[model samples]
Target: MVTTSTSVRSKSCLGPPSDMSPCGNWKVSIVTSDLPNAGTSSQIYIILYGQHRSSAPIYLYGTDRAPFQDGHEDIFTITVGDIGTLFKIRIGHTNSGLSPSWCCKEIQLWNMNSGKQFYIPVQRWMARDQEDGEICREFPILNKGQPILPVTVYEVHVATGELWNSGTVANVYISIYGEKGDTGSRQLFRSKNSFNFLRGQTDTFFLEAVHLGDLYKIIVGHDGLGPGNGWFLDDIVIRDPTTNREYAFFCHRWLDQEEDDGKIVRELYARDNSIIFARQKLEHNRKETWAAESWKFMKGNTLQFYNRLTGGFVRLHPDGTIDATGEKMDKYGFFDVIVSKGNICIFQSHEIRHLSLALDNGCVTGMASGRASTELRVVYQPNRCALLESVLVPGHTVIFDRHGKIASESAAGYADLSKEFVVFVKGMFLNNAVILLATSLCQALCLQPDGSCTGVGNQSEKSYWRVHKISSGICMFESVKNARMYLRIKDGQCDGTGTGDIDCHFKIKKNLENASVSLESTKSPGLFVGLQADGQAKPVIYTKNGNVFFYPRVIKCWHRVALLHNKMGMPSVSGALKRNR
Candidate 1:
């Protein structure tokens, strides 16, 4: 049982006298529990008691970033006198704020100088209305040997269906439940995508919590506010980055007070079909690498968009108009999907030399190239045509009327093949392999020990690289020889290496209808990792032929083993220049 205390200790006698030596800094991590009214807005303080000396009350406060949130971990550092062998700690809060009750899960402390760690478990409520009504609590040192739960940042993808007023401006909140536990309801405030909760839009968000194991269900709702509070939720996909596992929940319903069930909240369960579809989607993407083809090649390529509703193909005209009237794949129905950048695609009409399909003020029309409205979100799926969603107009997708003419581009609807676009071409795959410049296939890109990146002629172990996914469509290439070094784009150059972090991640975009890939730095969006004719690596602005083509060389496991063995004094092929084929 936890020792409850109500006595207030005077601050004058809490610390060592002014003439003593400091005991060094301590890193403290406090974990809040997932209990009702567990987060406190009041000022919190803690006093450490040791066998030799005690510490003054240290206020647990930091910058404007709020801490002590429910089901969250807060870290702080404090310096005190020689407090040898910590035995107990007195922790409390000034009873303030609307809800002053707090539930502490545990407190972990690490002596920075000595490298000693101490854990104190306090799974109790220190509130006035409950648990003996004590505002202060004392926890003694207990070697419970319990491991703390690892925190994970979960990727959440929320899709709004194409329907009348399917989007809401109300504050949305979601809670995920799994076999282990549940993530407390967190507000879906900031979205990686622009403007959250819009009709026909899919917003991506990140929620950090203790690992909840395999997710089973989720509760999603909104605080019914704003002009249009009714929202039509299409579906949700949550991915655990650590295991690369995804949980899919299909909620083809309305979360509105005036809708079908007149409810503003809903609980959706994970479905097997959704999970399979997600996996298949990933697999299909992995199999196909994208690159921008030459204008000559792209102009000759014929792409088709099958309109399911009209049972026809999207046809283009010389007057820069688009219609879904082609009964079969013909010259008028042929187009080319040009991959611009990170999921942004352009559909260039083969019938019209400079005309491209675009979202024109909520209407699907033909437009000239270089227009911002021409950029669309064309999602590639397995065994199916690609889905075309508007990037300029958020959730709107391309659709055609029964008469075959282009309908509204702002349709809030579920994915349908009739509303899908497709283009088949030879692509590249560079997930995890040895990278070689297309011009110099013998030289392999490597991250050196001296924090420099360049292309080496020998395909040694240092030339191998592993791709680590940072976020959706973003990844970092880490050196297989030394995990700490990564191929990084910095200061407009890819000639330097860095410790794989957010700064090192690159937005990988595939060129449509080609066999090469572009690595655009997440830090500097337009800067790409480029190669020179002499096999040198650097950052460059992407162009048609600035030495950006890279070919992936598949190295067998046995080959790596043989190289290691040869290096370990076996009959070695020293000075032998092994060229990558």
Candidate 2:
């Protein structure tokens, strides 16, 4: 119990009275501003021993002055003490008999008891979102493509899951289904809390999974009693543990701006004038334009479009002339174009070729003989020779001659006796030189130095060589090595007259040997020359329709010759000489 005391003193000290206990404990004195009046009475009140009725009370004692109120002037000693076992103090009130109202200026309670004070500190409570704090939500899936681990899931509502009501759902229960023909049923997770309708309280559910397939579908449903019991899904996030990066598939919706809406509305501008305007603007602003395909710099300052599939350059210029310097451009399978100084150059295989305008020069001049040459040629020939003219086209086969005249000259056609044209000559003939010439029917003709020609008559039909005229008297003839000749003679008398009759004859010259002979096939019908080699003998004469007798040993001391020809019909000796060099 708690106690208090009050006391008052006068300006003058009063003498102590003798009416006190032997201990000399107290001499109560009262001090008043005036003498006691008959209508007003002053009393001194003291609390000797007291107990608090309901609570501890404080006692006050003071001297009362004249102008003071009824309870202000009388001097008294006040002390508070607890009498009862309970820790408390009480105040006393008394009525006076001398006056209509009794006034006690000072009051005191003597002998006060003390009590122990007890107190408790006040406490406050508040709540906040988990994410709003330092804590973050745990990602569910782990090693999605690998083996799965045991999983624990918790359900949460989207509205309350986020600290800011980000309207996001975290770890919410989701039902997933497998693809078609799946043998297993869909799996489900549940929420941890339920909503209260009366208090309008709501709860969120959190879901977790150990592993997810490459493809899966999720189904959501509501279990609450609210009108809209559907799942509240907002921002769904995925996180990779290895990288610790969070990814979201959803983005916040934004209002469409007027410019964006106009662009959308004009999406079909590609077919309208707006697209043309946009393209013009884009081109004007663009620094450069890229070529669609590879190109090469051809002759006459022209860019050639290279065709990768064909391994050729498409001539962009009208003339389609590929320059000799840029011929290496064909090596590249693809190429691009570069512009410099307002001129186009093709960049291919790390090489650059400047383009130039194509000239209308009729033909490419100064081309070496027997090499490929192209020129523009105007063909003018007789109607009979027009067959050759029709075969040539400008920029391809028909080209201007060395005289700068457009000529219809080609080495490929048959020789024409009536016209002159530039011919792509591959071979030439020299005077007094022996050369093998093949006829239109592929028969080989051996032209002699004397302008006379001899051949095995139509070997394709097995026709043997029948000499019609041999110089009158014995004329010396040398047989070529590895060459054979067959001759048939006509019956004739000593008078230089002959009866026309022929027979088959064949002969072969032995290898590595040359033979000489002076003979005439028209001399006798039975004239036969048999040259034998390699154990094989050939009869020089055989009766075709009739036969007559002739001297058998007239051609003594003469041997046949054998000739070996190569694929080109040139003598094997010539081919061996060429290879030896």
Candidate 3:
């Protein structure tokens, strides 16, 4: 936690005492420390209370046009004309803390005449947002000493699951806190500008340079207010520059200053860096890949290599190709991700086998290729939930997963670049096969067993419902508040139930004309589900399905959307991306 300040004058301590010396008029050359990532340019000025022999000390401010930045530059040369001894000199800012305040880690004062230099170490205080109660975070700065692991802030993700409609801020900025020498802690780095964010979207934040093992506080905040202002955070990915080791920090909830339930900031422990998928590649040797109804194209920023020869999208596929025509089951696409030791494997539930191909021989023959290894180098993406995995091929390279893999701009792939903002940040890997949520028309409010959104005894937390797609247009609503319960059709009546039996499955038919969804009971076919104006859902017929208009909304993450496919069309549940919001 950042400590409160006490000094009325912006206080600071100086190093190496020096006696008052006089040659000509003492020339004070002050050099300010440069922090390039420390937000916008700030007008830094030193104030000196000039004391006369008798009268009250006069104040003088100094700083020429040259602003303070990440370099050694003479901010000003004060002409403290020969006098007994001027009062104390302190640093202050022209603008408030909203902007990056002027800060110097090390300040060198040179007496031009005597060529004597005095150095002062001032850590932190780059921008004091806490004083204004800005949404900030306080954590420790890790890895201070030699074998320091240079870690990087990869990206920020938020689960816009139902309740969090936080369009909270137009832009959010980040700052890093670190300790310097004897100085307790200060702002080590600040984002140059605010990053654009949407309430339930994954925003790629300004990459922050950091250290591992040491506690470092990161403050992600916005200076705006009003509708769509509550920010919910999902997770953050930190990467080791040297080994490309990624640590995933999963925070699945609301993070708002106004939140009474809880704060949005979290200190996520870094997972082992052993699972690195960055330099590896998951190659698909299967032909007619997309022909599998389970296979759909994922959206994101990774290269998707198409084997035009077989019209198959490489990356994720079943052990062997099969038609998904007669199954009313979870789309055979999503792979139940299994993390093993330092490696990972994709378990194909439908195939009842792990996805494997292109072994030591780099060929697609089950005969000669001994047995495909389940071991793979799981390189995590910036968001950390997804992987850019590669098979355990001796010297081969390339990586992939869901959150679609559009080739890097250069098309040279991972080898041609170090860092870049690809397509989508994170996604649910349907066995790397591109699985989508099978239900839609968008949004549903959770209903307590009594048809009340307010939980038993009026608990608010039990109100939101999370829709999990099971099959074609069929979904099960899980309680956002009560994990044990799910929206179900009990004895042909609408109610909340604990078990996910066939009665809980509802066929979500899209009424495009009405711009809503139709939930026809899968078990008791003729009856429909309806929601009352008071927000209660009940079993009803097509005529009374009026209030069934409680459309479930889909959440998407976006820093900026670059839709490669420009045209819009009706989305069908036959094959689509899984709904995880």
Candidate 4:
């Protein structure tokens, strides 16, 4: 714990010691009193020892006065390294004609430990209230030690009677304090006549070579008053030296309402470790312009364009062609399409139903068939592909063709028929899991652990059905009855449940030339499928579960093929068929 004590003294000068001779040093003195006139000026001098041997004597004084006014006294303080040096003090007129009647009250000397030594013949002075001012014989001395650390000083004025000035300057008076770790001594660094002229609201006074173990205390008194009130005294601060880092604190204020009487205060932290404070002001209106011009591209016209940012996923028009430089649709989605005939179309992830396309404009108007349910008259356009009315049916399949036809259809039994094409069963299997088969003509066959194949030639065998492992697992079978396609389980495997019941998945081999397949199961289940392909895995149409499917790469012209089936129809083939043919 740290402690401090303040002693106020009234003195005229620090007199010389009785037995000691005056060495070559200087001394300073300060006196406080109330003056009679407002514009009166007084002169005080700091006497110097060995004045006859040295050059001209330098004199200084100390006082607390209103910085802006002319009548108040002036105060000065001088610092010296050696205490053995001697000094003297006296009072004289700056300009003889302008000198005011001044009085010298008492004389005292302050030592390194705040000890006081007095001079005889104590002087007296008239106080500000016209009363006899007491001559204090004691002076306080502040000691400077070692272990020098950083310091902060806050100077505050105590309000005695009423509030003072009312402008920004009146709020400048602040209290000074030190954090726990500063070891240097705090003393009167300077006593300027105009404290208001200081540049900042807070000023930093520095001391070097502070001793390692000593408590630092801040002495606060009246610096200089504003225009309204004179000088006064308040409180002081003493803090122990610490080794911790220092951070800054700030406060902000704003008016609460229309009246000035109400205000709000907020505190904010710095964004970065080093940044302390920042302020910004924004305007109400600012114009923003996009660089690219809006091209007058038609709705059905397909053009190709690339986004400079993301390089994936090319956009296509409703007519199954790439759309570039197209006008943005009604701010809802992009381009608007109108249906010409009572056809089917798929938009986004849903399918439309009863879909009748307008012959002139290609606007689709009809009731949409949802997943497992149906809805009222929904309007859509083949060009825009926007669903004007949609009633969502959870977990049900909704299909839409490119011609604007929408319907809800069952995907269970059709899974067999879907094997002939690249089937995309949106809502068939568990979410995030879908089964795509190359062909339905390739019969679905199961392999036993004994390396035996069953259900090879039978299409209506009940045992050749696709069975899932407890609703969460999907069973995938390769339909290449006589061709070899490399099969490898990328993740999850089937268990040895010959019932083909397992809670895992498998994958086809990446390179078909090896004629070797690998299997991994989520629960390690047995899987069986026929393999029949030449050294080169060329695309071909095969039968699986009595359905016909073809791998598009088998044909040189068609590079890829995908079969899509939803509730409405085969909308997946709409765009691809238009492109390939």
Top candidate by TM-score: 3
Superposed Cα RMSD, model 4? 30.2
**Per-residue lDDT over 1-581 for candidate 4, one digit per residue giving the tens place of the 0 to 100 score:** 10121222223223443312322222233343333442224433332221122122233422334211123323333332233422232233232224343444443344333344324222333222222221111111222422122222222212121011111222222222232222112233322233431211232332221222323233222223343222211111222234332223322121122113342222222121123322211010000000000111221212222221121112333343321222222111132222212222222211221222221112222223222122212232211111222233222222323222222233233321110001111122222221222221222233333333332222232122232323433334322321222122322321123333233244332212111223223343333232332011111223242111111111011111222233346455446568798
Ranking by lDDT: 1, 3, 4, 2
Q: Report residue 135 deviation for candidate 1 (angstroms).
A: 21
Q: lDDT for every model?
A: 0.66, 0.24, 0.38, 0.25
Reference-based lDDT, residue 3, model 2: 22
User: What would the per-residue lDDT of candidate 2 be over residues 412-455, giving only the tens digit for each residue?
Assistant: 23232122221111111111112222211122223233322233
lDDT of 1 by residue, 517-567 (tens): 677888888888876533457888888763564544434323343556686
Misplaced by over 4 Å in model 3 are 1-107, 110-167, 177-195, 207-217, 240-247, 257-581
Worst 10 residues of 4 by lDDT: 284-293
- Write down the lDDT that model 2 would get: 0.24
User: Which candidate leads in lDDT?
Assistant: 1
lDDT string for model 3 (1-581, tens) is: 11121111122212222322431123333334455544335555443322332112222233333344445444334434333333223444444444655445544445455565444444445355522221211122122222123334443332332232434453444433333101111221223235344433454433433332332344544444555465655445544354454445444445666654655444444333324422221121012111111121222222222222122233333434322121122244333333333333333222334443222333221111223444334343322112323365643322221223323324555443222111111222211121212221122354545544311112223344555667756777666556657667767557776477887778876543222456788888867766543334567777633455433322322211223222244343323343433
lDDT (C-alpha) at residue 230 in model 3: 58
- Residue 198 local lDDT, model 1: 79
| Winner on TM-score (3 vs 4) | 3
Clashing pairs in 1: 162-412, 162-413, 200-395, 290-511, 291-511, 292-511, 303-335, 307-418, 308-418
- Misplaced by over 4 Å in model 4 are 1-261, 264-581
